[model samples]
Target: MQHIRALSAAKETRLTISVITFDLDNTLWDVEPPLIKAEYAQQQWLLQHRPGAVDAFDHEALLAFKTSVWRRHPALAHHVSDMRTQMLYELQIAGGYSEEESRSGAKEAFEAFLVERHKVVLYEDALDVLKRLAQRYILGALTNGNADIYKTDAAEYFEFAFSAESIGTSKPHPAMFKAALQKTGMTAKQIIHVGDDPDHDVQGARDIGMHTVWVNAQRKPWPSGNKPDREIVNLRQLPEAINHIADAR
Candidate 1:
């Protein structure tokens, strides 16, 4: 086993960890549930608000539409809010609503979908881990996907939340990490980033000198080419990892 150093009590006190940026989606909650629920809610909205239009559409068709849209506007891939609006518009058009009516219905349905989407249950240990870590480090959220952490009520724990939609840069690009550093006014050495993706979170943070913790919740094999500075299978192990890094310093 690769042993990591532990954070000493004195070092933990003196070492000011300016920020702890997190990846929002899988890192906090199991993404599949909320996403599936959102799609279902969106479909239901289409059936009720714009009936007969979906007679020709199905779940696969809806997904295909979204995929095509993203392929055409890759920049909007991370913009979930914009995507929701577009999806509503597409649903209206497919259902045979007039252009003006489709626009109006989309606005209403999109807002409703967002509310339903936020009813997500996070990992069992998510809040506990964040609460413990927040006592020592400045916590923030850095996500490549556009999820409004601010609306989730979990934003209370994060000092700041950033997304590719807001930053104009995505992970593995290095610029997003730099933006997080700028927001906290801390050097790369002062903060650590924790997330599930090796390329986007681990390698991206490590490339810029920020320590990284890989949250391999699924137990997926670590890809051969990219490796993280630290790896843990559960959120329960995170506090220990941070303490280890702090101890080493």
Candidate 2:
């Protein structure tokens, strides 16, 4: 524990602390519910709006379609709008709709899906943790999803929010981290990133000199080689981690 404290202290002084950029999806809330709702909404729209075009388009079918499309265009996976459009186009083609009809139905279905996606219920301790952290750190969000953090009512707690759509790059890419640094006017070492993804949040931020906290809510195993500076199973532990980082500074 002393060695851990010393290492934490040494890393803290490398940069002046100010901003803390978080990952929005699984880090803040259980994303599966909203995602499941969105897909369900899309399927209902297809059945009602497109009718005969899709007789058996269900949640499972949509999931398979989404996976297939993402495998084909991994970059598109980061942009919700793009992914929505792609789903509409693919569904239209698969259902044998005419180009014009497909486009029309896709537009309507996508909008319907978007409405359902916003009904996200955050984790129990997310707001409490954010409020506590905000007292000491300038909070922000770094996400790959298309939901506008400002629109989520959590914007007041964040100084600013960023996404792959806004930054022009996704996580695991150094450019996104650089953008966050530039936006906050802080060096790489100044901020600590908390996220659920090992590759995108932990490794990406660590690679760029930022300390990280892995929110292992699911008890996922840490990948070998790349490790986060801190790991916690819940948001209640986040404030202590931030304090540790601040104390080192």
Candidate 3:
């Protein structure tokens, strides 16, 4: 409210926001649950197909190994899906698989993980809200994660989708935002980016002069000095928040 009021006081003219970009993970759905399930599926596949692949490491050790893999390949950090496949391949090698066997086994294991990854449950009223918003705005999905929106229930509503893997960098970086601008041919002022992360969604968009709405479903305190133009507890409150921005002009 403080930020919204400040915008109202400072604005000289009304603004028109034609595009609304969103962060996929934690914004539309709780990502952790699906990710956990997918990881378990991947592990089970490795255990059955490539024996001892994950047997030597517990959860914490596995997580540490994943981090080590990431640290070893900084260039592929932005490409999470590729990084994961690489992790699987390396793990197979460590488990005594031949290089050729590891390559194919890694792919099959990743496929097992990916199939379960798509089974995400959207937040309540999320699809309905998207359907309503799509009528008026050019909706886009901007995510740093590997979630494929096209496989999700909200696919048809998004006019375009961009990911860190697709854009070669993650959010809080300008690459995805700039790509969105290029694709839509819309000014930053005419778009609003919404997401759960303050730094990734709010600060990143605001840095580029785009309006932002922080989806604070958890009712967390504002952790940063830079604030979003609007904040909402749920997707149900989004249209009103967007309306407030449009009308504040």
Candidate 4:
């Protein structure tokens, strides 16, 4: 790896990280609660605006509607906003709504969910660690989700937020990682990708020659023999773990 200035106090012979890319969903925040809330938000909106659909399509029927939408528009699977909108529109149509009515109603329903979705509850120390790391290294976000970095207080600390819609694909795909490097003008070795996923965050960036830090919040077992360069149980440990990686260089 090419020698670069270390961000941490610990010095290394050849520390290569200049930019740090993060995965947003479960990495910085517990996505489950907000997502569950968002779905409920959608359901509430449908209940108010399209009682017919809400009453007709129960849990199982809605699930089948979602499946059909994905089956028809497989590419939208990674684009959260579009996927939800498309699914809502399909459900509206199936509920006896006209084409124009379905489209407009779906857009409105998706907005209800989107508002709740952006109201995320970040993990403990996530913002603090990001602030500490941003002082020395460029910080960017790479994600498959629709979480708008601008909506969060932590937005100011991020240099950029790259997402599936912007990139036309999601993580586990090298193109997402490649896009981050190209946009930042940083070499793979000059960046470290940190996230909670083995495939999307760790393996994808690893394959591109970027160092990886797996934030294992769930404490799940590593699924493969190959492992990330570093692992941490919580966001609080990130700064020190990153420092350790730099020192190892």
Higher-scoring candidate on lDDT, 1 or 3: 3
Error of 3 at 4 (Å): 28
- For every model shown, what is its TM-score relative to the native structure? 0.86, 0.86, 0.93, 0.92
Q: What value of lDDT does candidate 3 attain over all alpha carbons?
A: 0.89
Superposition error at 226 for model 1 (Å): 3.3
Quality of model 2 by C-alpha lDDT: 0.79
As for model 4, its CA RMSD to the true structure in angstroms is: 3.9
Clashing pairs in model 2, backbone N/Cα/C closer than 3 A: none
Give model 2's TM-score versus the native structure. 0.86
The per-candidate count of clashes, in order, stands at 6, 0, 0, 0
**Which stretches of model 3 miss by more than 4 angstroms?**
1-14
Pairs with steric clashes in candidate 4: none
Q: Name the runs in model 1 displaced over 4 angstroms.
A: 1-16
- Against the true structure, candidate 3 reaches a TM-score of 0.93
Cα deviation of 114 in candidate 2 (Å)?
Answer: 1.4
Worst 10 residues of 4 by lDDT: 1-10
**Of 3 and 4, which scores higher on TM-score?**
3
Question: Which one is best on TM-score?
Answer: 3
Per-residue lDDT of candidate 2, residues 1-249 (tens digit): 232233344345555566688998899888888888987898788888787655655668767877898788877766768877877877788888888888888888888877877777778888887877776677878888866667675767887778888777889788888887776566777789999999999999999999899999999788776788889998899888877876876
Estimate every model's Cα lDDT from 0 to 1: 0.76, 0.79, 0.89, 0.85
Worst 10 residues of 3 by lDDT: 1-10
